[model samples]
Target: MNLPATGRRVLVSGASRGLGRAVAQAFATNGDRVAVHYGSREDEARATLDSLAGTGHVLVGGDLSDAAGAASIAGRAADGLGGIDVLVNNAAVNLPHPLATTEYKQWAALWQQHVSVNLLATANLCHLAARRMIDAGTGGRIVNIGSRGAFRGEPDHPAYGATKAAVHALGQSLAVSLAPYGIGVASVAPGFFDTERVAHRLSGTEGEAIRAQSPFGRVASAEEIAAAVLWLASPSAEWASGAVLDLNGASHLRT
Candidate 1:
């Protein structure tokens, strides 16, 4: 199965802003049609759609925390893009839930939320899109946005860390399972990146420390991570399937 170099149908979840937006833009600029999925940011999603470099981009909105919603999201994206050649599972919930300071109720709820959005939704969409690809007889790619915290740990956001680890593992498993179908699967585990949601944390003392985490003395730009994601989804990256590429700038090395 030969994947097209451009003009592929791509679906990017949580594309209303930040990393999602960058990924969408990258694909769009590469001449692919994108289905930009958002949870509750229709206006921002439209902004993403409008900012695309080419035509055929569409907006898809649905709650990713619900199973039905995940199905709907995949269905709509497939319909909008005509078909899905690439699925980028980037939507996630990452609220802080330090075990010691958080109450049981809140901790449990956050864990559930993170699992639903970060892990389960991704699994569901992968199944949905992979089915479509198999039916169409078109090989595809799946690029999951994991996190460096999965390896280094997230003391303040245990659930986020745990779910991302699951995401990485899922991508590897699917990479093997889907290879027979000509579908490549991979993941990107990014460390600190500058985005609107975390802009505040990148300033003052906190910003200094965050930058210090990387030997480069700087956090990554969303575009840098997006570029890696774009490559992993490309036709040349099929051999990279089942690999979790680390983009941490030497912050935390895994030997």
Candidate 2:
């Protein structure tokens, strides 16, 4: 099938595995110069990099928890690619801590990681990237990956849900704030996904229980979510800024 032809330059965070890897591959397949960023898991990141479709793939690594580091990462990518035309904020964490067991210490740690990777770091990159686009007088797209657990509730991971909610909100805020600079922002939230990393989180009974709620009786694949993201960043979605495309399979919808 013919997919949307991606932009010339793209930066995808958390691109070593899961949904991030899927997204990076999708863009690469469609002819985008993709910079794959990884927080850890150097081997996995490299594996994904080697597996991409385009020769323009580059592997970049940095701990995104630091605001300065995040900005610097953006700068490096812009310099390497001459300028980044697309930024995909897909790195995330969901440390499981129920409200009952959640203490300020745990909450703070989880909050820091989730907020930094999911929101703060993303915003930092967006801030820098938007300026680059503005200076070039060319518009760009920022696509963020969020979670359905945020809008509803993830019984075991309060930090994940809260941070994703913030991500959702940030997308909208950036849409209006960055539009003047000719930048667009949007989010894609996927429900209970069947990813390699999620093996422990949703296995045996737990996985089956969650899958029951999905009308399709299954979790979504990384490619499914990636396709939605591709469509969002495609030229067709240029006029679709501020959209939060849902890939929940009607599981979260209450009739």
Candidate 3:
């Protein structure tokens, strides 16, 4: 697929580590200017910036739970990069909050946190980025990092699944609404990835069973997910807008 223009301004949320870090690196490697965003990991965010292949990358920090902060993040990234040409909503909270064992207060907190960060924040950024792209006539791209859990279900983390499902829906909606402006929006629903946060589980006793969930007998890699995001954001991927691509190694197929 053809890549975006050189120096294209891109913003990746939650880029302090793991999949987000990989996504930021992919854009930079493709010659795009990146904005690395983190929630509370300032040092890690700066490290991601330092690791980028090109210059002009910047770091943006904010709490997604605060609506204003989420908006501010998009605005700051746009200003830092001269204007945002792509948005990768990769930041999300996936806390395990099984209803069977969780107390009411904890369950409520989990729901609030997940929705605020995963769904609401993504929505806010989409709005901010789309508006700027429209006003500038740049016709940008927005790629959301959804999850297979949205379809297969997350029995232990209902909020995470629900928020991801909402993300797919939001992306589709934006794809239709923004098409007139040449903006393309899509989502990638990936299965468990071998990210640092999930490395322990992948090394535990249940690791084999988890790996066996996929026919390939392995979890997806962070770079694999980043590649999908990079392609979905490319100018050549305009025809793929409104798609919710499954990157689960056929582990969980949806009709």
Candidate 4:
């Protein structure tokens, strides 16, 4: 298959593993220079970097919980890749915090952690990246990895759901706010994916129930989500800005 013809400077956050790793590989395979960003897994991040098909791929590390560090990631990537043409905000946490079962204090702590990494950090990156893109006067693309739970609901991880919904909203708001500067912002809302983190669940007794959620009897693959992200980041997809493209397999439908 023909990779993207245009060689863009792409930065993918949380590229240490799973879906983020796949997204980075997709961009690199398509002839783009990639900056692989990781929060805590430097080894895995380097593995992702080395797995890329092309040259000029670099590994970036930072704690997403730190607002300053999150903002710095964009600049570091720009420096590493020469300039960033696409930014993929994929770093996130999905810790369980079921309101019905958790104490108020614990729930509050989880909420703070979720908000700091998923929303605040993501917002800061968007801001810094948009500014850089604007200053360059060159068009760019931003693809955020949201979740179907944002709409369908995540009772166990309400903060995750809420933040993802906000992320989708933030993308739409930035799409309009940054259009004049030639920056296109969009998001992908994916259902449960077959990543290392969820392998156990996918293979356990609950696995059948999970698969039954979709008629296809399967969950999404990292590559599948990566493809959607690549399309959204493509120049041809500029018209899709502000769109929250759903990657769920009819498991959760919204009006």
Candidate 5:
């Protein structure tokens, strides 16, 4: 598997906006043809496709909370890109479901949602993409979007934190198993960043506190995290497989 430096085929899940959009743009800017995937934001996904630098970018939409949908997304992405050389598992669900205040049924439902979307979808996509990479015998790269809450704890969103922790572990396990097939797997644990989805939280007093969590007194831009994802998916980052790079602006440090 002789991987090229650029102009590869990439599949980025949840690329409709925010971090996903930034990641897709980064890869496109790097000369790779990207498959911009969205679960329910087709219009925004198309916008992301139009904003990409190079041509050949395509929009793929499907539910990722199930195995069949995962397969369909992967299949469409591979077909659109001709083949997948890199895959970014960026789709995830992070709903707030604090244990103390939430009802029992709501808690169980949210837990299921988080696990299905965050953990299972990622694992399923990895399997689908890696299978193609293995069959092609050309090797590939897979980058999973994890969360800092996996380590620091998501007391307000325990399911999100737990599922993300599972995702990190899943990437590590795949990094080991897929290496023999020339597939590199890695995960990025990003802390609070400036994204439209969480823009409200980054305002007034609460926003200040969030920014203060990092000694730098600032939150990261989507592009910053995208840069790291791009590097990890590059041909040079084969040695970095199995690593969980933290992009938390030093907000949470592990011992």
Candidate 6:
């Protein structure tokens, strides 16, 4: 009922577009100071900044796939808003490589991008954020964006699926490890959305079918998923830590 996040600060990675943009807007609308981090597309990032409800917003740039880059980005976010009370790991890499015909070099390249951003970088940011929370003694929230690919598996998207599966484990582990320190970690894995990525991947009848097959008779809007992420980080969702909210709209149901 009381979803007020006044004075709270949040950091959302990959905020240039898609789910990240929506999540950033959700938090900002709820009175939270937001930091929108993006790897590229300065214009899109600027648009996100201008769209927020409040003024204590920041736009950070860095490639978080490496340890140094991750730390630097987290530092900038922290510095901008004084500190970060919530961290949403929504940045990801999705490159499909069929197992049979995929070159080893291709596989490794995809592996590097996926593991770095989806796993290592997220874990690194969590570590930094939790440390701040621990020192402040006020606790914190962390929401990791996961996918249904972990469950149903995406054809040719081995790297994507693997990283998403690992993301769940990482969130759960962080939840337990930081529970004593007053930090809550959760995963919100969604199925299909009308993101540009999704639209590009599916075409014509196939895309239409995928959208129609959902229990709701359509794919989710970015705002819908963003709302879920905000709840996970809100004070009301403290008890929901370490829980995975499967938001696929039952598209993967086995009949």
TM-score of each: 0.99, 0.93, 0.97, 0.97, 0.99, 0.94
In the range 1-255, model 3's lDDT, one tens digit per residue, is 123566799999999999999999999999999999999999988889999997999999998778899888988999999998899999999899999999999999989999999999999999988899998886999999999999999999999999999999999999999998999999999998898898889876689889999999999999999999999998889999999999999999899
Encode model 5's per-residue lDDT on 1-255: one tens digit a residue.
Answer: 887779999999999999999999999999999999999988999999999998999899999998999999999999988999999999999999988999999999999999999999999999999999999999999999999999999999999999999999999999999999999999999999999999999989999999999999999999999999999999999999999999999999998
lDDT comparing candidate 2 with the true structure = 0.83
Worst 10 residues of 3 by lDDT: 1-10
Q: Rate the local accuracy (lDDT) of all candidates.
A: 0.95, 0.83, 0.92, 0.91, 0.95, 0.88
Q: Which stretches of candidate 2 lie over 4 Å from their true place?
A: 1-7
Candidate 2: tens digits of C-alpha lDDT, residues 51-151: 99968678888878798788777877877777888889998877777868788887778777777777787777778777887777767889999888877
Model 4 segments beyond 4 Å from truth?
Answer: 1-5
- Per-residue lDDT of 82 in model 4: 86
lDDT of 3 at 121: 94
Question: What TM-score would you give candidate 5 relative to the actual structure?
Answer: 0.99
Instruction: For model 6, give the 10-residue run with minimal summed lDDT.
Output: 1-10
State the number of backbone clashes in model 2.
Answer: 0
Steric overlap count per candidate: 0, 0, 0, 0, 0, 0
Give the root-mean-square deviation of each candidate in angstroms: 0.6, 2.9, 1.7, 2.5, 0.6, 2.4
The reply for model 1, stretches above 4 Å from the true place, is none
lDDT of 4 by residue, 45-139 (tens): 99999999989998889987887897778778999988878889999999999988999999999999999989998898888877878877787
Residue-by-residue lDDT tens digits, candidate 6, 136-245: 78888999999998888878898898889999999998899888877889998898888876776468888878888687878889999999998899887879999988
RMSD of 6: 2.4
Least well predicted 10-residue stretch by lDDT in candidate 2: 1-10
